[model samples]
Target: MSFSKIFGGKKKEQAPSTGEAIQRLRQTEEMLNKKQDFLEKKITEELKTARNKGTKDKRAALNALKRKKRLEKQLQQIDGTLSTIEFQREALENANTNSEVLKTMGYAAKALKNAHQHLDVDDVHDLMDDISESMDVSNEISEAISTQPAFDTVDEDELLAELEELEQEELDEKLLDVGPSVSDRLPDVPSEAPAHREKAKKVDDDDDMAELAAWAS
Candidate 1:
């Protein structure tokens, strides 16, 4: 039997509804926000304890506080991300058609791109949202493309020329950073025999005789 006949004969499982998926996303967002809040509180308490301690322990406590503060900042970013995802889920929920969905997804994509531009924290949730949105848009685009006429001609020579130019430009940049070739930098090796040649030759002959005697024994 063909592979498609075996696998395609079975009915594929239905995916969850958009509302159901959005609810799940919202729950996850809430959970992350709560965790972030807890981390923030813990960091704050540590900072307070450090402030009350004596000078000797104060330095150590302060270092701990700094570490905790860094963690708190990360958690705060997590909270922000959760909020952003929740917003995206809400937007997706309200979207009716593929076009509407695309619009909402575009908003999420733009938000993520802006976050990257501004050096904001990028979490897994943001990445997943971007990917999910892009995949949905891509499927629609692919479907549309499939309905259109296929192109028969491609300018391979033009593409090859562009590729060659790009490669040459990269080689040029690399050559600019490299010094002159080894032949230009170093003197040529001498062809003359060394003054110790006879002594060295005698040492090799003696070692060869010792090896021959050992092999004979």
Candidate 2:
């Protein structure tokens, strides 16, 4: 028999990719949701009919209730199928996402490896150590430049004492060069009052006249 004949004259369908499978599952979920909605509406209608026919027509009410039960069962089955399909779709999506992430991470790892191909750990460590040493040296140089000059060879207290003595000597020399005070330059004056001095002079004159008269007699 020919291959086509052996295969019933139809080719086997190709397997779906992950994306196509997910799409189909979503379509099935939509269909089941529609069916569930329809069954729910039918169940509601049957329940209402049964309630309305209650006690009035026992056969009709029982039939309506039976129909409602059948529709509820169908809705429950659709719900179950929808749950299963949704779980499967979610699991597939998660697997696909994880696969893509893993692939991207693998590429990143390869690129990183290539980037480090020319680098040696020992050489990198040596370079970093050299950089650290250079930074330390630079900091030392900066500190030296910013520091004030030392006065280690000088004596501050002795220098200040000598300066004060020199200042005192200069003041003494200036005082010696200056003339005497105004009181010393003025003429001497009598200790007594002017009226007393005049009275003493008159008394001495009178005594002299008396002596002259005595002498003449």
- Which candidate number would show the highest lDDT if scored against the true structure? 2
Clashing pairs in 2: none
Predicted structure with the largest TM-score when compared to the true one:
2
TM-score of each: 0.36, 0.63
Encode model 1's per-residue lDDT on 1-217: one tens digit a residue.
9887978776687987776777788788878878877887888877777777648687777787787878878887896888789788867677635657798999999998987885635666798899999999999999998784557566899989999999999999998789897778998766555747877999999999999999999
Candidate 1 residue pairs that clash: none
TM-score of 2: 0.63
Worst 10 residues of 2 by lDDT: 146-155
Which residues of candidate 2, in runs, are more than 4 Å off?
1-15, 49-61, 147-154, 177-217
Query: In model 1, which regions exceed 4 Å deviation?
Result: 1-14, 96-217
lDDT by residue (tens digit), candidate 2, 1-217: 7888877776788988788899999999988888888888899999999999999999999999999989888888888888899999999999889988999999999999999999999999999999999999999999999887786567889999999999999999998789997888999987777989899999999999999999999
Error of 2 at 60 (Å): 4.5
